[model samples]
Target: MSLSIKQQLIAQLDRILSAKLEALAASITSTQESRDSDTKSSAGDKFETSREMAQIELNNLENQAEKTARMLNELKQIKTTSTATIGYGSIVNTNHGTYFLSIPYGKLQLDGTTYYVISMASPIGQ
Candidate 1:
């Protein structure tokens, strides 16, 4: 049998989330390198401020990476074969548009079809 719309959407989401995780990790790495390189310079208030900002940026990137990883894990756990109802894993066709029930991940287009990936808790989804 062919893959369901839910399955196609899940595959697309996985690709998107994995790309985000990669970008975030690369950013974190670059930030750390910058922070470390700054330490070789002479000590001064400006140097301190630069290091502080880099640290904050690194921390933020790390946090975002963690969240993205968590989201990826959650997405993997979702079964894409279910379309019995307008709930999680459900790919619904409404008059206005199509919706893939899950996290509020914004718009996605696959195979000439547009889908709004949304969470059940959202007003539009509810």
Candidate 2:
């Protein structure tokens, strides 16, 4: 069956988030590997610095992946069939542009359509 605009948007968002999560996971894996491979060299503090940096990178990537996964879950819970009123899962169209009132994410392009996906709690959404 054909999907509605909302469903399509959610699908696009999901794809983006999933890809982001995958990239983050790969980065974390690489960072951890580098950290594990790091050894104390004649540079004294260089090994420690590299290990610390690798841990920081791994932490940041894991955090970002968690956030992306959370957003994906949120998209999955959204009901596509809704009203014109501005609220969560609502598509608000203005004289200037179109908006998908859900997440705080800014602009997204899909099939030649440009949609500003903003949070309902944002000032623009309000």
Candidate 3:
């Protein structure tokens, strides 16, 4: 593949990460608002339950946001220039399939060819 292919892949991953982070932030904000508004009504048990659920959801969303941010950082660190060896930012084309050693984004299609974007820490990547 050419440098442009890697650049395009990086751009796609960046967009995906940004959109995910944005959605997670929105969800976290909404959950926080809902939890804050859950005042102690006449039914204290119900209020507590609602608040707890919101808190759990907020925690999950926050975790996802952090992970997405990390992915964005990793993507930013990728160099589009070709490498002589199979390593980070390397694009490997085999008889079985093509692989992009970056983040674990599963499968991505570019110019009719499907590429697997995988992290170095992943089983296949290792």
* TM-scores, all models, native as reference: 0.87, 0.89, 0.95
Ranking by TM-score: 3, 2, 1
Clashes of 3: 0
lDDT of each: 0.82, 0.82, 0.89
User: Model 3, poorest ten-residue lDDT window?
Assistant: 78-87
- Which numbered prediction scores highest in lDDT against the true structure? 3
In model 2, which runs have C-alpha deviations exceeding 4 angstroms? 1-3
lDDT of 1 by residue, 28-68 (tens): 99999999998645668889999999999999999989888
lDDT of 3 by residue, 28-122 (tens): 88899989987899998998999998998898899999989998999999988776778999998878789999998889988898999999999
Model 2 per-residue lDDT tens digits across residues 75-117: 8878877654556788877898998877877899978989999
Clashing pairs in model 1, backbone N/Cα/C closer than 3 A:
none
Worst 10-residue lDDT window for candidate 2 reads: 79-88
